[model samples]
Target chain A: MEQILANGLYLGAQYALIALGLTLIFSLMNVLNFAHGQMYVFGGFVTYTVVAQWGLPFVLGLIASAIILAVMGALIEVFLFRPVIRKSKRDESTMLLAAGIAFFLDAVILLLFGEKQRGVPKIVNGVFNWDMRIIMPYDRILILALAIAMIAGFIALMQYTKAGRAMRALAQDRVAAQLMGVDVDRYSMIGFALGAMLAGLVGGLLVTITGINLGMGGPTSIKAFMMIMIGGAGVISGAIAGGFILGMMESVGLTLLAAYGDITYLVIFASLMVFLAFRPQGLMGKPWG
Target chain B: MTKTYAVLAAFLLTIFVLVPVTISATGRWDLYYTLTSVALLSIGAAGVWLTFYIGRINIGQGAYALMGGYVSAVLMTQAGFSFWATLPLAGIFCAAISVLIGLPILRLRGVYFAMITLVLTEVTRLTALALSITNGAKGITSIPLPGELSIFGLTLIPDFSTMDSPKPAFYLLAVTLMVLTYLVLWRIVNSRLGHLCRSLQQNEELSASIGVNTAYLRVLAYAISSFFGGLAGAVFVAISQSIYPSSFAVTDSVNFMLYCFVGGLGYVGGPILGTFLLYFGWDLLSAAKEYQLLIYSSAMIALMLVLPNGVLSLFDRKGRRK
Candidate 1:
């Protein structure tokens, strides 16, 4: 039971980070980046290269991966997403573009890294026993701690910084924000970059906990998208709550059902149908006016 | 429009007549098989196009396809049913499942619905992997070849083992199915229901205020889409003689959506053209080996940006001129 809780919390941290990044982009940009998972996958590979293959310190590799992916995020936004943001309808065109980027990244990753799963060595190798039977690894704790710290830092940044305020303003009302002298374009870049950076950080952290592979992006992206839906689209805090909900459900389902743990996703999907039918706005999301 | 369709029908008829002759004469069964797969995929893509017409993204068609494959495979392997019998049953099964799920979730519009459906495919895949009936990861293999279609053993179509390659008959069957699928779509788009569906796409609120049952229309469109997906999957299983959980992944669902986008979402015939081009185009990229995906994705991005209406629009513009 204790193991289940620990595993759930750890998984929840990764899901929370992924959901936070995805929802941040959705809130600010009003577009879903289907390639977000590819970015996360790339981040994992980068961390694996830096820390595992290159024999660098784990912390340095994490920071490097985050910075590199943030920059790539900015470039992708400006080059791929920005030019087409004004074209046709936002949903269809942007979706196609994001899917293109996703496929492109997947191919690029496959080309660069091949099809092997890579793992990073542990930053600190020790297990702490809370009780006689309950054991926790230092790396797992580090992942959880880093996840919370990064999320806290992100929230602080969004709450305190000038760029963050501009982002919040733009998300609230685009035309009004523009009227009030907020540079929509620049803030969009910043928001996208920051979101990608969070994905990268999470990717790196997840690699340390679980190995990274080429096919991880597609499923990861879907799960993160689900978290956003359950938490309420465009609601930041909702992403966190949704993440924990999914994580707990998965862990508990695995513990109780064992062989039938795969039903967790089906149950979530069915409940999502029910939730959308009855309360489409989700837990933290305000009712759509 | 009649002249264009007449010409297209003649062209399709020419291929239908010539393909078998050429394959048997030259022994290029691979070409016939590829064309057959394209037909099957196009049939599935056409279903997606219907949902697209109704202004909903049907990213979960893969789930239906997988379900259809399982239904057909199970019926064939265990129940000793003929493939022809399983085909309609697959479509009905998928359509029923879609209506069950579609009624509740179809109310959520845009990305919300798309996201949920996206998760639905993954869930279905996992379910297939875990289920006993699906054979649990190893998948049902050596699924018997479809039997002869006959009334009282008249043998209208030869059995799979008796055929030289099964490609010619499969191609003809797939083409017949493809033609039927599009005919339904074309008829739907021209009928009153199709107009109602198009109206929902344009302005759901206005349609709803005017007493159009928007929910019913959405569910109907979705159910039809899944039916087509299931039909295609049934055909696909017959061609491959097997079914695996991994056969239809979430990526294929994404690619199906892409097929519609690249084919031209404005017309019923778009996905048919899109699926053929993409399947063949991706095959052509095999020479690049590792860089194939990178180049393919780049081409997709460029194509969407430059020709948002799809490759068909190039012909659409030309056809409009004269």
Candidate 2:
């Protein structure tokens, strides 16, 4: 039970980071950014190239990933999503553009990073064994700490910063925010960049533990979607809650259903569908928000 | 109406007669496979288009397609049913499944609906992998070719195995199914049901207040849409004589929606044209080799950016006006 709780907490931290970025984008632009996972993978690749290939410090690699992804997210928002959203009458038009960007990023990653799984050297060595009950690697403990710190830092930024307040207002009501002197386009771009940066940070953090690969992008996006759905779409607190709940479900499901092979995910996804059917607003979100 | 008939005749002649003859004369037998795939994919895209018609972003058509393929495959290989008999059964099964799935999820907002449907494909794929009847990861293979079809002692279609090459037969089957799917789609779009669906699309709350059975229309449209996906999948399995859990995946689901978007959601024939162009355009970009996907995706983004209404909008002088 202790082992399961530890595992779930670790998984929940990383999963919440991924969900936060996606929900951020969704709330700000009302564009369900399909390319968010690709951005995450790109971040992992960036970190891999920096720390693994270039022999740079892991901290430097993490910073590089954040900066690069933030820039890419900003560019994508300004060039691709903004114009498409402006011209198209229907809001869903951005989905096609987002999916296209996903394909584009996937192709770019394939060409640049290749198809092999990539990992950075562990920052810390040895295992953290506690009474033979809670066994986790030192690297995993460090990653969990970093992930929590990042999440806290993100929360602080959103709660206190002027840019964060502007973004929150934009997310709450775009037209109202615009009327109140919020530069809608600039804040939207910033929100997207911040969201993408969170995905990058999580990617970089998790690379040491799970490794990264080209194929992980789509599944990551789907998993993130599940998290956001569970938490209530576009709600920060809900995203975190959804993340922990999913993490717990996965950890418990995998441990208990070991004899049943790989049916844990199947069950989780099935139950998620059923759950969403009953509570479309999720546990914390407003209806149709 | 006469002009419309004439145009339809010319279009049919081009696809059914001229294209085949040209391919044969040019000795481009490989083109048959490509064209058949386009037809099959467009059939799925038509279903996506239908969901779009009712103001929903359906990213789960791939689930129904995979289900349809498995249904046909299981029945034909395990139950000793002919492929012809399994085709409609697959479609009906998919429709029934969609009704169950659509009832709850269809009520969500558009983005939520899209996200849920996106996960549905992966769920279906995982289910296929876990289920014993789907043959797990190895998938069902070496299924027999479609057998002969007859009605009242008259043979309508011969067994595929008896032919020198089943390519033409498969192509014809796929194209015929594509045409029939579109005709049904066209008919639905023009009917009173279609108008009610449109009202649901425009404003669900308003439509419900104005006496539209909004829930029923949404579920019905979704079912019909999934039925098209199933038919496409069944035909595809027939062509390949195999079924796999990953046969119709998330990418295919996204592409179905992309077809509707790229073709023009406002027009009935949009997905067909979009599939043809995008499929062929990707094939044409194969010359780029390693950069094919990069170029194709870039072009896709640029297309969406510049032609947000889709390629069909290029021919429309006044743009899409409801």
Candidate 3:
């Protein structure tokens, strides 16, 4: 039980960070950016290339991932999403645009990073075993701590900053924010950049533990979607809650259903469908919000 | 009306007669496979297009396709049912299953609906993997070719296994199904039900307030869409004579939607044109080898950016006027 709890908590922290970026982008643009996972994988590769291949410091690699992803996010927002959203009559046009970008990024990641799984040298070594009841690597513990710190820092940034206030306003109502001098386009770009940066940060942080690969992007995106849906789409607290819940489910399910062999995800996904049917608004979100 | 019928006849003649003759004359039997694939894929895309018409981005059509393939495969192999008998049964099974799934999720808003449907394909794949009945990972293979079809004392279609080459027969089957699917789609779009669906797309709340049975219409459209997807999948299985859990995957689902987008969401024929162009375009880009995806995706992005309304919009003078 303690082992499952520890595992869930560690998984929850990282999962919450992934969900945070996706929810942020969704709330801001209503775009449901499919490329978000590709962006996350790109971040992992960036960190891998910097720290593992270039022999740079891990901290520097993390920063570089954040910076690079932020810029890419901003450019995509300004050039692809913004213009398409402006010109297209239907809202779902952006969905196509987003899926296209996802394909584009997947291809780019394959060409640049190759298909092999990659990992960096562990930042810390040593297994923390408590009475043989719970065992976890020191690296996982550090990653959990950093992930929590990043989440806390993000909450602080959103709650206390001026840019954050403007973004919140834009998310709440684009027309109202524009009327109130929010500079909608600029804030939208900033929000996208910030959202993408969070994905990158999580990717870079987790690279030491789970490693990264080209094929992880689609599954990551689907997992992030499940998280957001469980919490309530576009709700920060809900995303975090959903993340933890899913993490707990995964940890417990994997352990308990070990005898069944690979039916855990099938059960989880089926239950999620049933859950959504009953509560479309999710646990914390307003209807259609 | 006469001119329209004439033009339609001409188009049918071109596809049914001229194309095959040209292929035969050129000794390019390989084109049959590509064209057959396009025809089958477009049937699935047509289903996706139907959901889009009712204001849903259906990323789950592949689930129904996979289900349809499995259904046909199982019926043919285990039950000893003829392939002709299993085809419509597969589609009906998928439609019924979709009704069960769509009742709840169809009520959600657009993005939520899309997201849920996106996971559904993966769920179906996982289910296929976990189920003992689907033959686990090995999948059902080496299925017999479609047998003969007869009504009363007359043989309507000969057995595929006895043919000199089954390519033409398979191509004709796929194209005939494709035409039937689109004709049904076109008829629906022009019918009162289609108009009601369009109203649902425009404003579900307003439509509900004005006495439209929004729930029924949504479910009906979804069932029909899945029916098409199932039919396509059944045809695809017959062509390949095999079924796999990964046969119709998430990428295929996404591609179905992409076909609708690339062809033109507003038109009935959009998916048909879109599948033809995109499939052949990918084949053409095979020369690029490793860069094929990169180039294909870049082209997709560029196309979306440049022609947001899709390629069909280029010929839509009325759309331009608006």
Q: What is the C-alpha RMSD of each candidate to the true structure, in Å?
A: 2.0, 1.4, 1.3
lDDT of 1 by residue, A1-289 (tens): 8888888888887799899999899888877889889999999999999998889898888999899999998998888778777654435767878899999999988988888988877788999788756688988888889898887888899899998899989888899999999999999999999889988888888888788999999989999988888889878889999888888878887777776546777776777778878877778875540
Tens-digit per-residue lDDT, A169-223, candidate 2: 9989999999999999999999999999999988889888789999999999999
For each candidate, give the interface RMSD after superposing the true interface residues on Cα. Answer: 1.8, 1.0, 1.0
Candidate 2 residue-wise lDDT at B288: 98
lDDT of 1: 0.86
Better of 1 and 2 by TM-score: 2
Fnat for candidate 3 (0 to 1):
0.64
Sorted by TM-score, highest first, which candidate order results? 2, 3, 1
Q: Count the backbone clashes (under 3 Å) in each candidate.
A: 0, 0, 0
What's model 2's TM-score? Answer: 0.98
Clashing pairs in 1: none
Q: What is the C-alpha DockQ of each candidate? A: 0.65, 0.80, 0.77
TM-score of each: 0.96, 0.98, 0.98
Ranking by DockQ: 2, 3, 1
Order the candidate numbers by lDDT, best to worst: 2, 3, 1
Model 3 lDDT vs. the true structure? 0.92
